[model samples]
Target chain A: MSASGRRRSQKYHQSTPYLFIAPFFLLFIPFGAGSVLLALGMSFVDWPLGQSPELVGLDKFATVLEDPLFGRAMRNTLYMLVGFLLALLPLCLLVAVLLKQLRRRTANVVQVVIFAPITMSLIAVALVFDLLYNERVGFVNGILDMIGVGPVPFLSDSDLAPWSIIALRIWRVLGYYAIILFAGLQAIPDEFYEAAELDGAGAWQRFRHVTFPLLKPVTMFVLVASSIAAWELFAEVDVLTDGGPARSTLTAVMYIFGASFEQFDLGKGAAASVVLAFAIIVSTVVAHRLLRSDDRA
Target chain B: MPKGSFAGRMGRGTVIGLIVIVTAFPLYWLLISSLKPSTRLGEVSLIPSSVTLGNYVAAFDTQIPRWMLNTFGIALLTTLLGVVVAALAGFGFARYRFRGRSLLFGVVLASLAIPEYALVLPQFTIMRQFGLLNTWAAVILPLAANALVLFLLRQYFSQLPEELFDAARLDGSGEFRLFWTIAVPLVRPGLGAAGLLLFLNAWNAYLLPLVMLTNSEQFTMPIGLAFLHSQLNFGIVEKSPWGAITAGTVISIVPLILCLLVMQRQFIGSLTAGAVKA
Candidate 1:
């Protein structure tokens, strides 16, 4: 081949890959990359919508830090996060293990039933839960009435509302996470279980030694995913309680949405969201390190 | 073990059964409530004395069909645009070694950790600046560039046999032809899965649409239902919107249910496939 033709071929080869991949970067750079930087920049300026922007430096962060609602929001978020993880991890793991032991047909049916909620929109779920949590004539109160107990205000009560929201989240995600963990279980080599049986290990011991340890990666995945989701709680609270009776279910994300969109305080809202993002990052990092470091120690 | 005692098996069955019932009761209630007459309001009975289709009529009157149309358009377009772009990029990344490839791929992966809401402020601002706010483009453009789909497709495409690519190239097929013909069709499962994931994500999206679109005319199904819910006077109206809300909820979710029924295995597998592996 001529040298000019070889160089032309090289040129075609070099640019072809870029042409193929350009669409991703083209959209990503402006939207994804630019959005992050814009959010960061917006966090610094006291820029409400349709107003003169004032450079506030760390003032916006300070305002978020000092705001009592911010604290309450953070607290409520953590409350849901902790409660959700506590309910989710063990229950999902148990369900996944149970699913593993089930006959294929039964497991498929159960998996679909369990996972049905995850496919449903959260707004719808929250709306259903709202009706179910009504102080009067709610199915829940009806159940309580059947047991000769007085009507208990599920959402009206401050302490119970967050838990109720957490329950809704747990209900939505438990089966989905279980399916993920069940996939993890299926991926586990059969030899390990056989080896454990050969050692005369009981079922619990077999699960404890062979299943739990091997499922660490997936457990960690669920941990971070659910935790991030809990941190970003909005639609559920918005629909169920609207941050509720006395701001009980007012999560960080909800507060951010209300501040930015409703109140139009763009700067503070951005700062609050950045802080929430930081919290998610910190928690995910801490959780991941804890999970990884366990293998070492 | 499969050889567990009868009582133990029964106990396990009962536990799982109770859990499923509790978890699914609200949905069942929603269905039954949608079918019930307004006279049966607040009745906690599992079955209604008389089922009425009035609520569905009310629900449809509330512009739900429009909302559903909007939602379906956005989700479908997002899925199509996202899957196609991601497929091309995936194929590129998989087949050809290029300059700064790892750096670009790394950036895409890193973007995964950034939750959608975290960047809402700037994303909103960007939409405003581009005059895309309130338009479907505001939601569609940002959503179409999903890192998850890109990553999943890249991985799937890479696993395809290299020999196929070589043979295709030797047959004098150009890169674009190779990608459109050889790569995409071969990764049809991956494409379908990724498309479905994108569709579902866009369908269930709330925050973006909530912030983006101002007009009720442009509202997606979720937001429309939410508005209907909020406006519902809880059986006070001559024809209560509660039943309509329930019916709307059922209508909105029916597509998802159909999607699940149609692609149960692929849906579950594609979603969880990368969960632990990452």
Candidate 2:
């Protein structure tokens, strides 16, 4: 209770908070920051596993640019990215809107059922899709036969393979985004909708103005998050198609994995990963800016 | 929802029904195929013609049980350590206004944008240097400091009443005591939610383990099943691997489904809560 005791105690409080937070820095500095720096350093050198390192300068980046596989992988990744966003964004939002119309119990059960995929193994998902995409003796082909449509090569055809992969992703993530957006929807005060109605706003008009903007932050978060995952599209590609059917499902991360581990070309893999990192950072930053621009308007 | 319109209600029901089928059918198909006789796995019947545990028996021939143990070990360790560390820092950042607080927090938050693919190459090299390659630590350490976990915990800690802390302080309770006794118990729900999310993320982790764990003995469930699926597709073995793949897939997902069903509220809460605004 003395003044000097109080002074010492206040000093203790100031410094002990640092101790409380020390554990994060201890792990993060080495595992997070240091590794990132080392990765950037490794990108310029030819550091194959079990081989003497040699500085390669920009050659790795140039090699990535010149590689035909890289081109195909990039194209495939972009195609999936575009197709996924085109479907996922509006579809999740629409699902959220429709969810509002359901009885509470039905909606909750439906939510749990659809959200089940997020918990399932991506490999399981890949195998399941592989079964469905089988050209012969598959459920899909059987259905097509009944409908008078020829058996479609969902995974075997390059043109359809990427889209098929996209469909699987959409199916996997639709519930996740829908639930997040629905939570965001719950945050929008009913007063706003009532005010919109009083102002003669129809459902479409209210959604176009009020719902969309209020949902913007969550939407942007999902966009960047999903886009990041899309860029790192390795597991499905690895399991389902193995970047096959002429590399139609080949992805940036798959290419990186093949180069680094399979071939032991660590430098090339690091370089490609660095390039992808920059793309993710740039896109995410742009997304943040887009969110800000909304505030500005 | 068009009020009092039977057609509109039917239309919504139809659409939702279709969506449910599209999403749920894959899981259903997996379970059914996993239970079917290997000879009948190729058949188009939605339900199995003959239910058998033969596929599961075959799948056990692979290293699935061992892989599951490894994955479970990794996820459990990651959750235990990650939650404790995140909780300490979460309490620190929540209660204290120390020097460079915002700067440190912002730096941590900024690291979220660095995708795992970008970090894996360097992380692999780091693991190699530490001689952690082919070990579970390679996966656990990097994944432990999740930005969302810290963010979720910090946000939850901030919501704790300052009066509780001050009251404890007035009673001469030390900071750690207050943190352990008051802050932690209050934010237990947040911690539980964050831990479950982290465990699932770690369990479902694929790329890092695939790259680091070269030895078949050390493979996690995802990578193991992936290897199994590849073997089935390539048919390198004499017998078909479909029965095993389906069975392995089914086994791989059971834990996740159990966890999700048990912690449905927390799983949904942690994910949707954080993503809603940030």
Candidate 3:
């Protein structure tokens, strides 16, 4: 090709990348980053529905902070997050380890069976759990009755409602996370376990020494991802309890939802959302740091 | 005991059996109860003596059919638009060395950390401002710009050998033709994976649609079902709505379940791949 022709083609190549990439930026700028900035701006102003916005600076945040219901929502979310991580981490780990022990065919079937729940809609899953937790016609209460135990108020009692909601969340997500960890486990060669056995390490020692450390990256991924999901708890609670039974299951998102939509207090909702986003970021950073510190050690 | 020993095998079998049953029983109950008489919802029996298709018939009479169509249309549009844009962007990032490329890519990845809840209110305001509220576009537009899909496809495109592109370019192939014909076909699996994620995310999305859509006709399956559930629980609907709920639940989930069964490898593979990379 001639020098001018080559120059033109080179220029075309330079511009082509921009043309290819422009579409994503076009949508993302107006929606993704734009929405976040808009939320940040909205958080500082008192924008009641159908009314002109008034800049209230940090007062909206202060109101959100002082609101007893927001406090409860955060507390409930934290309580459930702890319980959820406590239960889910070990259970999924156990499932992943046992899955590693099984033959490939058997493991695949078992994995699919357990992984099915994550595919189903949360609303449907919540409805199924609601029925199962029903006092009169539920299968769970029926079993409890046969065992001479009174029916459990899974969603009705404030104390149990959060845990009940957590259980449903765990059930839906267990296999999904476990499958991710299972893939992680599959990456750990059998040589490590065999070497541990040859060194007179028992199963527990093998796990403690060999499995846990190697699985840390995947485990950390699970920790951060699941905790983020835990923090954003809404749909399960919304469908199951509507943050009901004395607002026991009122998640941060639900509080935000109620404030913004039900009450039409967009500023308060935006403020609460800002707080929630900060919490999520801080927690994720903390988790990353904690895992990194352990990795160093 | 050793793994293959009798006690170990028995223990493993028992654990597997329990896990399968616990994980699967609720779905089983859902299927069975939907087939049972709606009037007998209070019955706690494990099995119904008689089966009826009445619940499904009753469900069809509701707005569920419309909700399903709305959700399907929205999810499909989101997937189609999301994948095309992502594919282009992914190819750009992988194959090009442009100014501010890293910064631009960083911006895209950073958006992943912003939870949907944080954006929903502002997105609602934007949609309302544009007079797009209560329309299918309201749901599809925001969801179509999915950062995760962009990230996943970028990872896929980055793995391709540059020699192929170079050879094609030397053959006087146009940039668009090279991407559309050579690069895209090479990354077909990635496209499938990205497409599946986008579709499922849009299909199962509740918060965005719930915030943007007020009319029942525009509600997605999740919102529609949640509405039905709340109505029944609050006693707004005195008659049995359990049948409709259960039947709707089944109809809503069956297609995705079938999709999972068929594409089990891709479903599991792509999810794991994304996490591992993340």
* Lowest summed lDDT window (length 10), candidate 1 chain B: B232-241
Of the two candidates 1 and 3, the one with more favorable TM-score, higher being better, is: 3
lDDT of 3 by residue, A167-201 (tens): 88889999999999989988999899899999999
**Fnat: each model in turn:** 0.59, 0.68, 0.68
Off by over 4 Å in 2: A1-4, A8-14, A145-149, A289-297, B1-4, B236-238
Report the first chain's TM-score for all candidates: 0.94, 0.92, 0.95
Q: What is the Cα-based lDDT of residue A139 in candidate 3? A: 75
- Using Cα atoms, each model's DockQ against the true complex is 0.65, 0.66, 0.67
Q: Which of the predicted structures, 1 or 3, would earn the higher lDDT when compared with the native?
A: 3
Please report the TM-score between candidate 2 and the true structure. 0.95
Q: Give the winner by TM-score: 2 or 3.
A: 3
TM-score of chain B of each: 0.95, 0.95, 0.96
Docking class of 1: medium
Per-residue lDDT tens digits of candidate 1, residues B16-114? 888789877888998887888755657878877889898888877888889999999999899988988898898889888889999999888888888
**Lowest lDDT 10-mer window, candidate 3 chain B?**
B231-240
lDDT of 2: 0.84
Which of 1 and 3 is the better model by DockQ? 3
User: Model 2, range B144-228, lDDT digits (tens) per residue?
Assistant: 9787788889999999888888777777788899999988888888888888778888988988888789899999988888887
